[model samples]
Target: MSAVYSVKEIYIYPIKSLAGISCQQAFAEEMGFENDRRWMLIDAENQFITQREHRILSQFYPQISDGKISITFQEQKHEFSAYEHLDNPVQVNVWDDKSEVVEVNESTSKWFSEQLGFECKLVKIIKPGDRKHESSRLKEIFNVSLADGYPYLMIGSQSLDSLNEKLADKITILRFRPNIVISTEVPHEEDDFTTFKIGDVQFKNVKPCGRCIMVNNDPENGKLKKEPLKTLSKYRVVNNSVLFGTNIVSLNSGIINVGDEIIF
Candidate 1:
């Protein structure tokens, strides 16, 4: 019998370095979702901070609805009403590059401060510039327009299952935090897919996704597990970075749905 492949899951992390939401369908863009990761929290010095340093952010819940983004933490909720205007400004560094972005303002900042028990501000990435993927295999400079890294991270459902089969304890797949999860034609076949298309959009494979300690942290309870990480370290090492999935830059913009057949 021939094998079958399809898209099995879709997820979007509305806030950078926070918990993500599982969706049945999502609009794909060159820079990721329409508004995903557009807003991030930066320190007083305008430096970017992520789960790599502050795991407390894993407890924050963020959602998008009706042109507004609402973030909830502890017992309080703060909503941002400005999606059209990019006026409130602050300087923030995505990595080493600093870009001026609109801060979410006092009302939103207060909620985060109380939740994380720290002084921090919400900033949005709106400035369009040349963002590139550093690959020795490429002959020309590969570029993108949004925040750091590629637009999407794709994983195979079977791939995770294969990994879990080797583990002593079963863990939820959300720990990986992938944007697209597809059921490839064969087991681990996604590892060979260079370019895939769904609807009218084509995505070019960029690089292997590097795993981190965040994968061990539960997105819901803000807790970490050691067994899974220890298991991955044995087989998932790549270029000194622990890799789990493939990062892709979109070749076109379109809506993608769960169960969509991806043509390679």
Candidate 2:
């Protein structure tokens, strides 16, 4: 029998660059999955901070419960109201995109400052109009959350399995930090998928995600590694950039769950 392709895992990073929480199901939104990358950390200059610069960010763990989100770093834990709306708007930068975001609160910022050992503030995306994903291929612009670029990112399980086979040290899929993981026999098959569906929702596969130095930062040990990126560069290089998961944009909003069949 041909290998069955289905949604195996779902994840959401409520705060950009921090740890993600796995879920059995996720609500698809126009910008991204509900609560995915809705929050982010910015320095004193309002520039975004990520694992790319501070590997310790991988050590921060966030958990959602009882209408509140709690983030823990070492022995310190801070909780925030799940849907709290702070009206303090501030200009922030994410990559090349600059937009106005709502400053979460002083206490949240202080908590992060203590953890990262530097001055930083936590902010949330309150207005979708503040940011848009400019696409040369797509006729219409797409709204995005605080994610690097695209709204959704997907990787086939076999893709990681294939990469791990070539490395002396095996790495887990969490290193990839994808929102959606699909089970497939053929590695990198998602690269060819232009349009597909999960359950009843349609998605347009826009482009292959370019692997960055952030992937080198191991999520568990919070240390840099050279296996996967080193191996991927040897064979997966395209246009002088190493490529991995495929970025997707939702064409419709709906509920997607694990075990949902992926229709190409």
Candidate 3:
């Protein structure tokens, strides 16, 4: 059959809750995209921190290199070793799951503490298998990353386009933070396909992503406002959850690129 949708964009969140980096192509690894959500910041209580509490965290943009990731905030840049010299395997609570992560370094944690103006530690996954959340849907897909629930999020381009048409001010897909953007003709078309394939990998849409206030966070200004959320509730509310995108789990591993056809 002829393809009905094509990948419009690909993104990876190297650090959970921080800014995401857009890419023309990405590798679908076990937990998530390669280098996606491998690192995250946690509070002194060993609980994961996110923009939900510190809205300004949306301003921290991360760019990953071969051996390091440079985060920029307000024109200032701080660099951290991506996967070198991991120290101290500490257990962290990401939402409800207690996943084990290693400290990137003391200096990196110290810098993040200063930046966020609080005591926090920078931690990274030792490997894709370092953290596993048991699930029966996909036997081989229990390896969850720092992501809230699933390894990937897929949003139909038409969904955002439809949402934008209803609002006075339009927003970018970055607000939704989807890893895969499929160009479809119908809004929320992603919901129609529960199983699909892209390149050598297969994916399943677990459920509609229930959004939170973090969507109000403006990555451009490090500020929060009741938007998209408030408007989304008008029509997207279901069982007390305001959903905008679909949470996805991978069935295999492979490279996906922009403009690639999504075979259903």
Candidate topping lDDT = 2
Summing lDDT over every window of 10 consecutive residues in candidate 1, give the lowest-scoring window: 138-147
Give the clashing pairs for model 3: none
Each candidate's clash count: 0, 0, 0
User: TM-scores, in order shown?
Assistant: 0.89, 0.96, 0.94
- Give the alpha carbon lDDT tens digit for every residue of 1-264 in model 2: 255689999999999999999999999988899999999999998899999999999999999998799998889899998677579688876777777788788899898998888999999998577777787656668778999989899999999999989988899889989999999889898887888889889999888999898998999979998768888999999999899999999999999999999887
Cα lDDT for residue 228, candidate 2: 82
lDDT of 1 by residue, 29-116 (tens): 7778666666777777777778868887887787888888777777877788646434766655566444667776776776787777
Clashes of 2: 0
Whole-model lDDT per candidate: 0.73, 0.89, 0.86
The residue pairs found clashing in candidate 2 are: none
Question: What value of lDDT does candidate 2 attain over all alpha carbons?
Answer: 0.89
Off by over 4 Å in 2: 1-3
Please give the TM-score that candidate 3 achieves against the real structure: 0.94
